[model samples]
Target: MGRGTGPSMGLMNDLGSKACEAWLSEHGEGLPWGQVVAHPCPNGWELRHVADAGRDAAGLQALPPGALREWADTADDGLFRPLKSAPTLRRGWRCLVSSHDDLELALGGVYPGGLGDWWAVRTGQGGPTSFREFMGRQTGVYRGVRGLADEAARAVVRACCHAGSCIKDRRWAVEGMVDGEPGGHGSIPCLEPCALVLEAARTMARMASAERTSVALSGEDLAVLRAALERASALRPPPGTREAELSAPDNPRRMKLLLEWLGPEWARPAASPQE
Candidate 1:
């Protein structure tokens, strides 16, 4: 939208900028925040509650100056999750989505952690509604950046579309494809939406290589494909993200086998955690 940040949003940006400046002053400018922090922006910054309306301007004006980090720097190019949680929603400091894109478009987090499993939901008739359907009606920033690049990415988005319809809407077939498949866990049949998305991506990359050239992804073509798929990957909320979290296999057996893939501050398991 506009490049304006309302009174509240303006204040958050001020604090986030200040926090970044403070961090860089200590941390140095050689490295980037995305490389340093896994869950960057709106999460791992310093913030003090500013209750006084009078003191805010001074805070904004007094911000330490330098070539500060931008939202794109921390943006995983829509890798894990694109939506950032608003700090006002939580009692913490949040980073700016970008100076160019209105601060109003940075709705990244659904709920902060320390509250328990951020993905828990009610079962039975009162189960969670379709996240995309729910979010479509809202004015959150997540709605601002939706959609993917190619048919495969579209497949991932469609499969990950949060419609509990998969639970019942069996348009695919009577096969177990609707149900989640195994990754490492010996779950039921069918492809897990997350695994399906990843697999679809790999398949697409392979096809892209074969169709375009026998060489690997490079230059602008690689960049474009990566952005599209990553954005698609980021669009799915935490509930959908659960599908990807599993470590099962990516075999699309016994099911239709057509590939497909955040919420809260969903914590990811380490690459190699101690057993």
Candidate 2:
């Protein structure tokens, strides 16, 4: 039941072990799985198939002694493929470039590094031109500015929309109260986003309690606690605030008080929830 342990933990460990094995097979020399190399497909055919075909054709021809016999035998079916012959280097490079282009298109023009980086590492040469470099070269373009501006605008819009929904739901809960009783148990429906915010607040309190017991509270920890309290205070319903009327005893006020004691910024509000 603990975080990151037991059967679930064992599964994670198994996955990590498999991943390491796969990586070593691909990059490690002298290994059966490592003998095979794949490049992008030439003529825009699928790379995996092309690589397999290339491996098969190369094995059929005169190859040097001590070549990967097992790889060549199973080359047509299994994951392993023989390295492309030295004569096919140019064709392989073309395939690599084409494959890289396809990946860039799929990712919406966001190329992480690029063909040049791959080529440099594979060929053991100077660093290749990277996606970061491409961005650097186009800094004066309107598209660059527009991309950043649009992202920022969207983030602001989402935050404001979330806050508005929270306020609206709180108002509805207050209006739906029976007999004007602050602590009345009414079946008030809440918006999904508002419910999420409440759930998140609850989760944070639980985490704080765990941290308080397990770890020595340092100055940095106090600072974090204070900041969290200030944030809760900012969202707290004003004294007699509509939200306070709907909230249970274990509500935002508890978070606010814990935060206030950590910092001056968390002072309790002057008015009561039903004032």
Candidate 3:
């Protein structure tokens, strides 16, 4: 796909360039100091928004003055307008897939499979009809293998350490094996999706370490984890599982198990405290 040539092109380019730099400094080199700014670019905000914002933001103040106007004038309206539409989702997906390929070229193919590849397969097979459908179809795959790995990894970490806390609390855990490295050793906590889990684990681990208590993976917790694994394993295309089944039930067994694993001190009553 061609780049949008709208008046916002220069502004977008400038923003993209800054974003790339920020991403690289933070993620690539582990820099300790850098300022990164992000603003929502809603569909209604046209080239003027980009130009105006660029002028206002300190980081973008250095941008060539005429670049924004020139970009707007030369940019193709048809290309620029469609980019503001919902179709941009697919376009963004494709860009991600391509970027992965580029990374593989430079970094020796670290990722085993591209998300776009899996998405393509799911969409082509007539799985879920939309992005929502795609998420439902694939979340199971993540929960099953990746989820199990995460659970097992945490369990093992707790078992081996003095903390006795679930690994989920100590570090971020990821679903896929990197470069065939097993037992989730190479996983980093900063990446997306898994990052949230890693943060939770880190918090738990810190708490356990501070309290001088070990994480206890009781039989009930294991059962709950296993059930989650089972649900993940049983997942199929959207139509395969009724929407009603996806909704959380009141007093879910999983919730009870999780609370139990956290211990009574951590558990709270379902209702809020009175004022």
- Of the two candidates 2 and 3, the one with more favorable TM-score, higher being better, is 3
lDDT of 2 by residue, 1-275 (tens): 11122212333344333332332234222221111233323322222222343454443332222222332322222322112111111111111212222322211111112223333343455433322232234333222422222222222223222322221211122112234322112111122123232333333333334445455676557567666655765553434333322234334444543442243443334345574
Q: 1 or 2, which is superior by TM-score?
A: 1
Ranking by lDDT: 2, 1, 3
lDDT per residue for candidate 1 within 46-132, as digits (tens), equals 222222212333343221112122232222223232212211111123232233121212211221121111112111212233323
User: Per-residue alpha-carbon lDDT of model 3 for 115-164, expressed as tens digits?
Assistant: 22223333353121321122234443233222233444343223221111
Write the number of the candidate with greater TM-score, choosing between 1 and 3.
Answer: 3
lDDT for each of the candidates? 0.28, 0.29, 0.27
RMSD (Cα, Å) for all candidates, in order, is 18.1, 25.9, 20.0
Worst 10 residues of 3 by lDDT: 86-95
Top candidate on TM-score is 3
lDDT score, candidate 1: 0.28
In order of TM-score, best first, we have 3, 1, 2
